[model samples]
Target: MTPAEVRARATGPTAGLAEGYAQANLIAVPADWAYDVLLFTQRNPQPCPVLDVTDAGSPRTVLAPGADLRTDLPRYRVWRDGELVEEPTDVKGHWRDDLVAFLIGCSFTFEAGLRRAGVPLRHVDQGRNVSMYVTDRQCRPAGRMRGPVVVSMRWVPTALVGTAREVTARMPAVHGAPVHVGDPSALGIADVGRPDFGDPVTPEPGDVPVFWACGVTPQAALMASGPPFAITHAPGHMFVTDVPDSAYRI
Candidate 1:
């Protein structure tokens, strides 16, 4: 069933299956820590871009109007003392009246553009998660949040490089533009085969490795800081919102 259709039928496990709508990486922080994390996202717009921030205890975002944050995503990770303790299909048990949620655009938003542009995404084509790595590069620190910028990598044909560039460049709100376009080593990525998260994709002779700032940046930052209490969407499961791709232009 479609994610939206399934979501309508039941509020259970198949939470965000109807993807291709605008997807966002979610971060739920204790109210006291919300401002600091907001500052971090503001400082590093490329790696930790902000799409929306919800008032404490509210899951509905202006980005999607009536969408429910706690149940919209298929799964969530609950962290305590900076360590992941539970991977819940829904955050109902973790939800709190004092928590605030932030929604950041996911790379899938741009993948739609790439698919439209004919730039094949091997990871999605193969139904495998995109490869992501933590770079030696650091995001500008804000408050207590600081970590190496994490990136999601994809391989595209040499001939369609310009197409990949042009389409993604138009969607900065969803992490537009490739951060690195050639050698993986330039990004301090030792071996494309050894990714920190997600599976690796094969690079054909003429395909160049292209990396983008990932929506998962917050998860990496969360692990590094280890906040007292926080929640985030599971890696593959994301909130499919009512917004459209064109809404992210800027």
Candidate 2:
């Protein structure tokens, strides 16, 4: 990502310009509440798939050892009192000595699986972010963290629907399965043209919309919790990890 672009997202620029390695989602919360949030994650494994957790007051991820959470993400969102107030690329200025970092699995980790299976992604093709929505469904709540389940949607050709499911099902750490499929209204989505978070994609004829348990689910929970402070990787931005996809393969 360009400096100006990362600045806009406030998550910072993507490093290791050459090879595209693994990337994880970064969620930062106050140390006092880290235990609660970590338990929430453990309870909701699929939605808050934890890759690594930093020690109290540490921003460095043990899994991605040398990586720095404060400036590694291409974008970051700062939430205050349950409402988002800032979307910065880096959280250095906002970082606190009491902060705790959690590296969670990201959906981007499975894009290659979808591509290998030959399922077309309209969002990537059209240069738009995947569609995401806030569903009527509620997540397994934990202390101060509970709310509607948020999901990301991708339209796939009817013929390739099975392929999409098969490929993605292999990576549960990264939203392992489709929570819902085919109907948007069933998920409380009134209009596919305008998504709640990311850009909407054109759903062509013979394409079925598929939804995945998005990493953003935690963000939704954070919003509901309205903890005094919280941080997350911005939409489309992620934290690159050192692990290989093969390591997570089933």
Candidate 3:
């Protein structure tokens, strides 16, 4: 689907759509908070890899020139003092001249590679958003940013675990490599069938739960820090960029 088409619906998740294009997570903060977020991302690259940063008050990104950040994504979450206020299809109503939007790499960029290598994503097959969980693990805090690490989980066939890792590792900018290969309990995930964000997908008999650092980690930090105002893509609804998946693949 084209980015414009995705923007029009503005209510569905972006998973299993826009194949071959790189997807990104959006985080817009007031100019005063941009530096702290920048430091937070730099200190925790695994979960918050920087893809592009727009100038304060500007909604256009270099990653997808001509696309409007305020309306290009399928959905957006508006936060006030760290609390979710609304899930809007477009954020033009909330746009501010002092907001700085950050586009972060998303693991969706590597899903095509996994599929090409014969790894199946159960969520995609089931037509559900990928499972995400907030772990007890704490990210290295930067300035006012501090929160538990968040991860997206996929059930991979046990035999293809190695191939999955190798395929994803090539795209380091999009959260390459699995953080945990099995046993969701190890990551403080109580139940694989119940996720903290997005819908859950059951694991097959030979499937092992694999976890990857998620772009949602920064959102968790933004909430914990209680920023006055912030904007982010709703979990699983990413901004599709014009860049191809191959551009980020090593």
Candidate 4:
């Protein structure tokens, strides 16, 4: 589907949508907090690569000049004082003049490359949102932003793990390589079947669990270090951009 189609529907996850186009994670915070968020992404590049940043009070982005950030994504999470207050399809009503929207690179941008390489995406195949979890590993803090690292899990056949790694490693802007393979307990995750966000995907026989740093790491930071107001794409949902995925591949 096109970004216009996604805006029209305003629901569901964007994984596998717009096959070769880059998709991004959205996080719009007050300008006062923008520098801190920018610094946080700089400190944690793998999970928070910045694709494009909008001017304060403006929803326009260079990544997709014609798209409106307030309504382009499938869903958004509104937060106040670090607590989630709403999950709205459109944030136009909640939009503020002091907001600075950051378009962070999303792993969905690299799935096409993986698919082309014959790496199966179990979540897409199962028709479910990718599983995400908060790891015991903490992200390096920047100013007022601080939180544990969050990771999206994919189940890959043991033999194809190398292919998955090679295909994704070239796209560092969209979270490059797998952070962990097999053993969820190593990441301090208690259950593989129960995720902190998104749906739990079942691992088929011969499949091993692979984890990648996720853009939702900012949402975890928002929950950890109470920012007065913030907006982020709901987990699994994302803002699809006009840029081709290859533009970000190295």
Give the number of the best model, judged by TM-score. 4
By lDDT: ranked, best first: 4, 3, 1, 2
| Worst 10-residue lDDT window, candidate 3 | 2-11
Model 4's alpha-carbon lDDT is 0.93
The Cα error of candidate 3 at residue 195, in Å, is: 0.5
TM-scores, all models, native as reference: 0.92, 0.90, 0.97, 0.98
Model 2 lDDT, residue 105, Cα: 81
> Candidate 4's residue-wise lDDT over 33-126, tens digit each?
9999999999999989999999999999999888899988889999999999999988999999999999999999999999999988999999
Against the correct fold, how does model 4 do in TM-score?
0.98
Relative to the true structure, how large is the alpha-carbon lDDT of every model?
0.81, 0.76, 0.91, 0.93
* Better candidate by lDDT, 3 or 4: 4
Model 2 reaches what TM-score against the true structure?
Answer: 0.90
lDDT of 2 at 121: 71
Residue 80 of model 3, lDDT score: 93
TM-score of predicted model 3? 0.97
For residues 92-165, what per-residue lDDT tens digits would candidate 3 score against the true structure? Answer: 99999999999999998899889989999899999899999999899999898899889999999999999999
Model 3 alpha-carbon drift over 4 Å, by segment = 8-10
Among all candidates shown, the one with the greatest lDDT = 4
RMSD of each: 2.7, 3.5, 1.1, 0.9
